[model samples]
Target: MKSSPLALGLLALGLLAPSVRAGLTAGMQEGKVELKSISQLAFGPEGVLFIADPKAAAILAVATGDTAPASGSATLRAEAINEKIAALVGTKSDDVIIEDLAVNPISRRAYLAVSRGRGPDAVPLLVRVDVQGQPELVALDRVRFARAELPDAPADVAPAAGRKGGSPRTESITDLAYADGRVLVAGLSNEEFSSTLRAIPFPFSRVERGTVVENYHGAHGRFETRAPVRTFVPYRIGGEQHLLAAYTCTPLVQFALSELKPGARITGKTIAEFGNRNRPLDIIVYQKDGRDYLLMANSSRGVIKVAAEQITPAAKSITAKVSDTDGLKFEKIDWAGVAQLDRLDARHALVVRTGAGRALNLETMALP
Candidate 1:
């Protein structure tokens, strides 16, 4: 194989380091991070960790400095993860709440967003799981980090429409993901169209208002705009980047990345209605036998494996009422009580699920 002239020029300009070339950390500053809360976590290039602080209406990008390429097999299993985290934090197992889990693609290490307590004063902490499945706190004492504050976060005092005593502000950021040098944030905003999806460029520039999004819910027999996306994953459809977002009452919608412009209102294509009265907790995209699939964890529904081949460019939208699951057929996996998940390797997934005695457990399972 021979290097092309463009490759040689790029090498000379040091553009091979995708992160540096894209200014992933160009404007970041080194300091201690004061996180008010940890609602979600995602990993970008060069071990940069994106933490969502919904309470603070901000997103922090921390350079985790865990970029050493993983060696050998990265399979992991840790039973009773809640107890382990409680023991590590000197709290009761029942008080430990794991909010989210993300695996560093480069290091293959798992990082968790945890709440040490279950009350309003609960302390937020980030924990790292070693190759041996041991939980360790990630110190925020002095690290390179950048913060992006949402300019139009909902009012913290406003009570949610249906949930009594629940503040809409707390749902300002429900999910976070890194894709193609941008951080995609899904949650509610103060704008008239509360439900929003934001795409923020890396290196922390001026945070802009999010793109308002709406979707037709087949199970509900109506369109909804105020409900935030519970979970979503970036996927390619017909060779173009798009987001596959799952919302409460289980509607799977698709939005093109190019259409998520600032302050724009867009209607997503509803491709599937998984069911009703269920919340999508997490989602991961993987490939098997040269075909892509979506592994989703739900609150009431068990894990499901959805074939990505059905999301073709000409796929019809599910607009009518649904009795059960409709559009883009799925196979329910035997996995039960799954709360959070991430891809650990090419052939395995790291999942946190309830085990005996309702205790949470972390384990890696083969991609079905």
Candidate 2:
């Protein structure tokens, strides 16, 4: 799975695609709606979907064929980790934040990345809950984070500054994915603009520790490299296990899982870089009619759709314009926090957008 340096160099240049393009159609007809601050999202077996609202400290269950007022058709379940996670991390029940949620496909279990900062009781933990209603911190000791370096800061104060700085180092895991019998976690370093990707082996009953797969510097290739990653989705492309990473500051970056295994160098080619200057905030990959498509939610623009084939090397340039059904032009709304797009059937999807306060928007869109 080794990519020649020549191919990798070409990838670096190909990543810089202009944001200006025409043909994007927007409107309520395209299934656009307002939503609360959506912190995380995932689709369950069948047509069931889940959205995590960390600000609300609750997970909402939305049934199929639902739209706005998702709270009506959605069952809001309060996270049970309020007290337990707090005790484990030695932080206030309110501060023991649940940053990301990962569902195990095999065991049907759920894992949460809980961060407690730097207090005596503050120990970031990777916690898991099985289907039988049992919950425990899985990889507590394996979780290690280097405080980002800050300007004119003392060594001891670096970690604290990094935690307070920006999107990258917020002292929490921004995204998590379960694949190939392992758990992948992405964390941001606020003081310095960077994020680290770590992998934890699965089947917790057998292993007690996980290894740091890659200590990725946020700005390794592009000019604005430190933009913290907004989403990481594991997918198999062309019979190889690869990961599609979307940054809040840059376009998408792809890497083979083999390149991330222990002792492997951190060199990944930029497969496809799309979206505007505002940074792509969310992304999801799903199959429709036996074809794969990458759906991206941008902070400046709305959702952009691209077929998997359009991103391959042969395509050269992938282009699409957003437009309404009536051929009218529509502007992208101010998207906030976290959002998710999930497959509904062969031709449609369920989109959930969450923002500040209690705002939550849900819509159903037909794929083009």
Candidate 3:
């Protein structure tokens, strides 16, 4: 549960008039959108869907106009969602790849970034799940949309230096989120210090060079700059906005939102090392009993719950290496086989988890 942005707050309170909200797309064009690939998905005010296209090295903001307010208490459960999506698209469950899931806060409907096939030619599809747990394709054939291209994205070719085998451009934009009117993108860049984070102001402006980030990876036992942030959530610490970012070979690093400037290099404060041989998949912030908490899903490590109250401005940074996980205590959750997760509402979470016969099921559960 990343902190809801101001736009969301206003929309929830019915303070953002339809005319004022339409201003968010004032400069945008309306037409068919051709996406090279869809890597990440996020939502902004007035039902604007932010789609990250790594292959094209661009971000497309589309006016989904799905602003129908939802009953916050409603829940959704679509079992074997992958198979269902495959059936809907005339494919097999194994061929349907669910790239990411995002819950449109206003609609309380789930949107999934899906790859219809598994090769380079795999078609990208944006599928929306209704409250009745049904899957439907979001029509992007003709829509009001705007695009922002990264000025310094990595080349769309080959294995990058010091890497085994994978397209550098594919990881050019690993994760992005809309917060405080800006879309924060994290991934590799073409610069010498490649791990970058860009805070591109919304409404489709020119994308500037992102702030290069480096952190002390305890598992690797040294400082690193190439490993991109796997997943992160926007949070507030000491009355200022910050990103609680997690990286591969897990390191929980903190970066002030204000410090992210064009062409600047910043060393994030490493607060915790969850361990090596693990990749953080997704993270969300939620509150229970009036205290905030962070729930993160991992590959090797099970879902872990961190008391957000522990993350303070005075918390010490883990500058030195340790044998395993260290700094900022966290408790493992009982959730199993969770591949992706997002907050469906304040009280429920939408998860794509493994079920019988290796099938992926989409279900909503009470926030743990």
Candidate 4:
């Protein structure tokens, strides 16, 4: 197949993408990674990928070394790759569903969260695709890993029927982020009454069930919700660091890390509202001209770039609706179907984008 002009241009930018700069670490030694359960994933410091396990109530950090994805990797169409993955796991193409996508900054390889079927039969598979665009099983046997279990498990509300089959075991983990020696997790319990965040300190010490983060939304300064953060990246404004979290109906709220103490009820400052009925997929903090920007991917409105400085001195909350160029203006990127994204380095972001004919393509592109 011949490459279209658009594909060629994207390839050219990919060639110039930034290289991984993470330092090496002692890859897995003891404390095996139990794949019995998993919901969310995020790359932490020292080439560690934090895996959230709510069943055993533990989070695992596995060592993945610094190997960048092949720079000019030819596209590996999602349909074809899914077939191959199915073959490896003894299933047909229709039986597998790609739940999530994340790229390792250290390896440049993409990780795919897959379910064998759904509900109780929904066995999860962690697969990695390399530069050649080949799918490989991320075998968990004998890898360096550390685990930390959440000391608290709140009661469950009746789960939403699993994906067509009600696979409630794995759908609880909504998002994960790593920053400042802590792994921040956002999840919804079975009860679904409220959402929660967990800041697990690395080196396997303790799990801190984070404070409840609520935001004043909609008009009239009311209509708050405990909707879990779908995806987030740590951002710094001034001298303080904060978790820039996105909730359902799409409100971008910031919660200071210092104030997220255990059992404390905290409210996040609503900085920007993406739109109503929108589900935010991924977010990354990027910089240009020494100015910072927050890039968010959504299920419907495409990818958007928000000026980070707007939030530093923002209103206490944005209670009204915003048009595209209104308060905390958002400029949408022309690229469509970005299911997940992560900053590979300063100049580029690794993305899982929708390909022609319902396929998924993992590629690196210039930062917007």
- Candidate 3 ranges beyond 4 A from true positions: 1-22, 154-171, 189-193, 206-225, 321-323
Best by lDDT: 1
Give the winner by TM-score.
1
lDDT of 4 by residue, 319-343 (tens): 5545732347789887687876777
Give the range where candidate 3 is weakest over 10 consecutive residues by summed lDDT: 211-220
Better lDDT candidate (1, 2): 1
**lDDT over C-alpha atoms for residue 220 of model 1:** 41
**Which residue pairs in model 3 clash with each other?**
1-284, 1-285
Specify the poorest-scoring 10-residue window by lDDT in model 1. 210-219
Q: Say which prediction, candidate 1 or candidate 3, comes out ahead on lDDT.
A: 1
Candidate 4, residue 284: CA error in Å?
1.0
Q: Which lDDT value does model 3 have at 177? A: 91
Root-mean-square deviation of each candidate, in angstroms?
A: 4.6, 16.4, 5.5, 10.4
**lDDT of every predicted structure (CA atoms):** 0.82, 0.45, 0.81, 0.67
* TM-score for each candidate, following the candidate numbering: 0.87, 0.49, 0.86, 0.79
- Candidate 2, residues 1-368, lDDT tens digits: the string is 12467756756777522211110111002122222233454433222234343322223333222112211222112234446556655556656555545443223334554556534344444565543333566632222111111111113543455566432323334665556644565655446555556555432222323443443422324322334557877877667788878766444666777676553436334455553465665566767778787776666566656666544433222123323211112234333333444443345544444533433333345654
User: How would you encode candidate 3's per-residue C-alpha lDDT over 1-368 as one tens digit per residue?
Assistant: 12258877887788875534557877688899999888789888778899998888788999898988896488788888999999999998899999999998888889999988999898989999977788999999889998988765444454466576744333457788988777888876544445667788776655443344443333334644555677889999999999998876568888788887765666678888787777899999999889999999888777888999999999978867577877889998888888898998888888999998968899888888
Candidate 2, superposed: residue stretches over 4 Å from native = 1-170, 205-208, 213-227, 263-265, 312-338, 344-347, 354-358
